[model samples]
Target: MATASLSAFTRGIGRYALVAALAAVFATFAALAPGFLSGANLVSVLVNNFALLAIVAVAMTFAVSAGGIDLSVGTAIDFASFAFVSLVLAGQPIPLAALGGLAGGALVGLFNAVLIAGIGISPFLATLGTLFVGRSVQQLLTNGGNPVYLPPAGVPEAFRFLGHGSVAGLPVPLLVAALVIAGAWLVLSRTRFGRVVLATGIQASVVRYSGIRLSRVTAATYVLVSAIAAIVGLILTSTVTVYIPSSGNAFLLNAIGATFIGTTFDPHGRPNVPGTVLGVLLLGIVANGLLLSGLNFYWQQVGTGLLIFSVLAIGFANRKAAARA
Candidate 1:
C-alpha cells in the first residue's frame, strides 16, 4: 500500500507545470523591479485574488478533469452574491440567506447535470444556457440591469470575520485557501471517489464498463463544482462593501486563464493545486504590481492575456513532446 501510494503521489506531482511557471514569473518580476516583492504589495495581491482564483480554479480543475466545462461559473458567483445579499437586506436570517444565495448557483449546476448527464445534451450547450439563465435572473431580481447595494445587517459576524480576520498571523482568505488546497489534495489523492472521478476523466466509457455509476458521478461533480463556486461568491460579498449583480463577469476570462494555469502547472499529466494557487497569485501580482507602478487597468488586461497565453503555449508544447515519447 505504501509503495503504491508513493507511486501515485509522485505521478501526481509529475503531471503539474504551474510551479516552474511560478518560479519564472517570480524571477522576471524581481528583475523588473525590486519593489515588486515588497511585503505590502505581495500581501495586497494575496488578499485580493486569493479567494477568487482559488475557488474558481479548483472548481474548474474538476470540470476539466471530467472532460466537462462550466461556463456558467462566473454567473454562478455573481448570482450567488446577488441572491445572498438581497435576502439579507430583505430581513432574512444570515444562514438561510446564504443558503438562498447558494441555491441560485447550485440549481444552475443541477440543470447542467440534467442536460449533460441525463438527457445527453452537450456540456457546452447545457452550461451556456444556464449561464444566461442565471445572469438574466440576477438582472430581473435587481430590477432590469442595475447592480444592487447590499445591506450590512444580519450578516453573521463569522461571515464578515472570514474575509477580514486573521489566524496565526495569516489573513483569513489565505488561511482558507490553504485549507482548500489541502482538502483538494486529500480528496484527489486519498479517496476512492477521487480516483474514480479522475479515471472517468481519462475515459468515462472505461469506468462505466468497470461498473462505475456514471450518472451519479456526473451529477455529483457538477453540484460540488457549483458549491465551490458558491463559496467564492460568499467571500466576495463579505469583503466588498456592496454586492454587485454582475461583479463576477470580469472573472470569466480570469477563470479560463486559471484553467490554463492549472493545465500548465501539471504539464507532466498531473494537476497541481498549490501551483494553481501560485498561478492565481501571480496573475493578481501582475495587475496590482502594474497599477502600483503607475500602469492603467487597460494595459493590465492586455498584459494578463499575454502572460496566460504564454503559459498555455509552453505547457502545450511540453505535453505534446511527452505524448510523442
Candidate 2:
C-alpha cells in the first residue's frame, strides 16, 4: 500500500512538472534579471516572442492530433510571406495581398493533401518532400534566395497594424493568437469533427469502419494546418516589412518541440491546445529571460534544449513509475 501511494505521488508530480518548471523559471528570471517582470517586457515577450510561435504551435497540434507531423509548416509560412510581400510590392491592395498570402499557403497544403491522402504516402515523407521542394522553389523565385522588401513609402497602415498595432489595449498579433487558440480548443474539444479526427489518429481502421471518409478528413486537416500557419507568415512579414526566403523555417523545430512537450499535459499523452499554448509560453519566457540575463544566442538555445529535456524526462519517468505500480 505504501509503495502504491508513493507511486501515485510520483506520478502526480510528473504530470504537473512542466507547469512547475514554467513557474520556477519565470520567478527565477524575475528575481535575477533586471526589469524582467516589467509590464513592457512582459508585453514584448507576448507580442514579439510568444504570439507567433503560439499560432504555429497550435497549428502543429492539429497535425499531431491527426497522427502526423507537418514538416512543411515553415514551407507554408514562407509561401504565404512570399505571396503577401510580392503582391504588396506589385502595388496590390493589402486585402488582396493577404488573400494571396493565404492562397499560397493553401496551395502548399493542397499539395501535401494530394500526396498523403490521394497517393497514400506517409505524412512524414510527404511533408519532408514538400519542405525540400519549398526551399528550392523559394530560392528560384528569389533569384538565389534574396529577400523581397516592401518599400518604406509604400507600406500600408493596415499591414503595419497586424504586427504592431493594438486592439482593445492588446497587441493585434496577440489578439489573433488568442482567437486561434480559443477556436482550436473549441474545435478539438467540443465538435463532432474534432472527435472524429482524434479517433482517426488513435485508430484509423476503427474510424474508417465507422463510415467516416478518412481521406477527406485528412485532406481537410492538412489544409487547415497550413492555413493556420500562414497567419504567422502574414504577421511576420508585416513585422519585418520584408519576406526573407526560408525565414519561416526558424520556427519549425521550436514549434515541434513545443507541441510534443504539450502532450505531457494529457494523461493519455494527446496533443492539446492549452498545453501547446503553455509550452509556447514556457519557451518564450525562457528565451526572453536568457537574453535579459546576458546569455548569447548559443547559450540560450542550450538552456532551452535542457529545459525541454528536463520536462520530458520527468514526465517519462513518472509514466514509467505509474505503469510499474
Candidate 3:
C-alpha cells in the first residue's frame, strides 16, 4: 500500500512538472530579461512567436496521439500556402482562395493516408517520402525556390484579419489558436472517435479486433492533422503576404519536439492537447527570453534543446521511480 501511494505521488508530480517548469521559466525571464513582462512584449510573444507554433503543435498532437507521426505536415503547409497565394493572385475572392488552399492541404493528407493505410506503408517512411516529394514539387513549381509575393495593396482586408486583426482586444491568431485548442480538447476528451484514437495508439490489435475500421480512422486522423496545418499556412501567407517555397518546414522539427515534450505531462506519456499547448508556451518563453538575452540563433537552439532534454529526462526519471515504487 505504501508503494502504491508513493507511485501515485510520483505520477502526480510527473503530470504537473511541465506546469511548474513553465512558472519557473517565466519568473526567471521576468527577473532577468528586460521587457519580458512588458505588455507589448507579452502580446508579441503570444501572437508573433507562439500562436502559429501552438496551432501546428496541436495539429501534431493528433497524429502523435493516434500512434503515428506526420513528417509531411510541412508539406501540407507549403502546398496550402502555394495554393492560397496563387488563387488570390488570380483574383479569386478570399473565401474561394482559402478553400482552394485547404483543398490543397487535404491532397497531401490523402496521399499520406493512401500510402500509410491503404498501401500499408509505415507512417514515418511514408510521410518522409511525402516530404521529399513535396519539396521537389514546390521547387519545380517555383522555378527553383523563388518566392511568390502578393501585391501588398491588393491583399484583401478579410484575409489580413486572420493574421493581424484583433477581436475583443485579443489578437485574431490567439483567438484562432484558442478555438483549435478547445475543439481538440473536446474531441479528444468527449467523443467516441477520440476514444478510438487513444486506443489505437495504446493497443492497435485490440482496436482492430473490436471491428473498428482502423484504416478509415487512420486516414481521418491524417486528414484532420493536415487540415489544421492548412489553417496555419493561410495565416502565415497572409501575414507575410508572400508564399515562400518550403518555408512551412521551419516548424516541423519544433512541432515534433513540442508534442513529445507534452507527452511527459501525461501519466501514461500520451500526447494531449492541453499538454501540447503548455509545451508550446514553454518553448515560446524560452525563445523570446533567449533572444532578449542576446543569445545567437544557434545558441538559442542549443538552449531549447537542452531545455527539452532536461524536461523529458526528469519526467522519465519520475515515471520510472513511480513504477519502481
lDDT of all predictions, in order shown? 0.72, 0.90, 0.89
Error of 2 at 71 (Å): 0.3
Q: lDDT score, residue 127, model 1? A: 82
> Where in model 1 is the C-alpha error above 4 Å?
1-17, 152-159, 267-272
Error at 211, model 3, angstroms:
0.8
**Candidate rank order under lDDT:** 2, 3, 1
Residue pairs in clash, model 2: none
lDDT digits (tens) for residues 1-325 of candidate 1 = 1133545444443333445556766677766755878887678677785666777877776776677778878877886787777777787877788789889678767878888889877777888888888778777877887866655664567657656878888888777777776777667657887787778778889989998898888888787777778777877787873677666767766765676576655535545455566667768777766666656778877877787777777667776776777
Compared with the true structure, what per-residue lDDT tens digits does model 2 show for residues 156-208? Answer: 79889888888889989999999999999899888988898788789988989
lDDT of 3 by residue, 1-325 (tens): 1123556546557666877889988998999888899999998999978999998999899999999999999999999999999999999999999999999998899999999889989889999999999999999999999999998987889879878888999998899999998888888777999889989989988999999999999999998889999989998988899999999999999899889888877777789887898889999999999888776878988988898888888777877886788
Q: Determine which window of 10 residues in candidate 1 has minimal summed lDDT.
A: 1-10
Question: For model 3, what is the alpha-carbon lDDT of residue 173?
Answer: 89
Model 2: lowest-lDDT 10 consecutive positions: 1-10
TM-score: model 3 vs. ground truth: 0.95
